[model samples]
Target: MKDTKDSWQDSWFDTCAALLTDPQNLRVWSVIVSLFGDLAQRPGDRLSGGALSRIIMPAGIKPEAIRVALHRLRKDGWIDSARQGRASAHFLTDYGRAQSAEVSPRIYTRAAAAPEAWHLLIAEDGAGQTALDDLLLAEEYFSIARNVALGAGPVPEDIDDDLLVFDASARTVPAWVRLRACPPELSEAAHGLLRDLSQADALLPRTPEAISPLQIATLRMLIVHRWRRVVLRQPDLPAAFFPADWPGPACRAAVFDLLDRLPRPALAELEAE
Candidate 1:
């Protein structure tokens, strides 16, 4: 009976892992970014190469692929590696940590944001176009058109003189506007993640002891990687901005449910493995 149960659990884990794997955006570097952001974004946190390999390799990432990805990330100023004797350790660089910090709140937030106030900034056709573009890039303003941008929360006190600004709220959201705000690809990705999370949740063993720390780490990385891609790309706009069928809220709920079940293991626990 013991052997039979073990076999069943092993098979279930393999299936769940397979279901969670995303081949479409399987860039090793991006996965590493997610892992670091999730587990090692702290000031002094770092992971040895062996630990990194163990955590990421279970997701079908090759050791050589990890080495290549690390090199690319280092070259691109997203990560830094140091060697002490024969062992090497990797950590996010300042730029990388900053980038990770920028999105960590949104990615890890348990509740969705509902901004109390909203505003719009409109630029003259040719006069303030460059300034508006700069604002869109530098700030969290969503671009509605070439000359108009929408922002959440209160209007800024010191506003740009070249642009016209208004404290606004949505009166009506048409299909065209909804499609523009939440594109088909974004919606598809959200639904796909929702399905994957649901399937994995169903297959996961009920007994938490059945799952190993390494397995937990690997699964968390996969979940966070896919979730990060979707959440970061899609702004946290009000429901009116999204189509009625948008799966983002559902996907987020599922993602957090799975994450709560698969709690993060300590760095020492991961490294010990």
Candidate 2:
């Protein structure tokens, strides 16, 4: 019985590791960003070189790759590293932490929040286009066109006075409008993630003891990383904005289901390992 149990555990670990890996183009730096944001984004939280390596290496990233990524991140002002005697530790810079904090709520939300009220802003063809474009870039407004923008909830008091604003809700979304909101490529990526998550869910072992905390951390990073890529690209538009066959809702459900099963391990627990 002992030998059989051991075999089962070994098989489970291998399968879980494989399932969590990013089959698509693995951007080592982006993966590290996800890890730091998820596990070490607290005000003073930091990860030692060894701890960072241990958390990320399970995804098949090499130590050399990690070194290069850290250098690039530092150069880009996303992270800073300090040395104590022979050991080094890394942490996000204030700018980096702020940027991460800005997106944290969106990335970690288990359920989508659809606002009850929405408003549209329309600019005169050539007169107010630039101001509208700036608003689209600086805020969460979805661009329906060069002169049109959609935002949730009530119109802000600070909106540009030159542009026309009206309270609106989606009534009938045509194919062209839906296609414009969620392009074919984004739809494909969403569907692909859904399939991968479903496969991973099936491969996970029934016994909770079969997995360790570090393993849970690794898996959560992968899940969150992939989900972030999809969700961030998608605005919180009405359901009508999505394609008829968009798999976003289904993908989100699967992601949270697996995440609920793999509860997060404390940072100390991960570092201690």
Best by lDDT: 1
Query: Backbone clashes per model, in order?
Result: 0, 0
lDDT of each: 0.89, 0.86
- For model 1, what is the error of residue 132's alpha carbon versus the real structure, in angstroms, after optimal superposition? 1.7
lDDT of 2 by residue, 1-273 (tens): 999988887676667667767678889889889988888898888888888887788888899999999999999999999995698989999988998999989888878879999999999999789889889989998889889999999999999998999999889888888888898878888888898888888878777767777788888889889888888988899898988899988988998999889987777777687
What TM-score quantifies how close candidate 1 is to the native fold? 0.94
Best by TM-score: 1
Candidate 1: tens digits of C-alpha lDDT, residues 209-244: 989888888899999999998888787688999999
Which 10-residue window in model 1 sums to the lowest lDDT? Answer: 16-25
Which ranges in model 2 have alpha carbons more than 4 Å from their true place? 1-11
Task: Score candidate 1 by lDDT.
Answer: 0.89
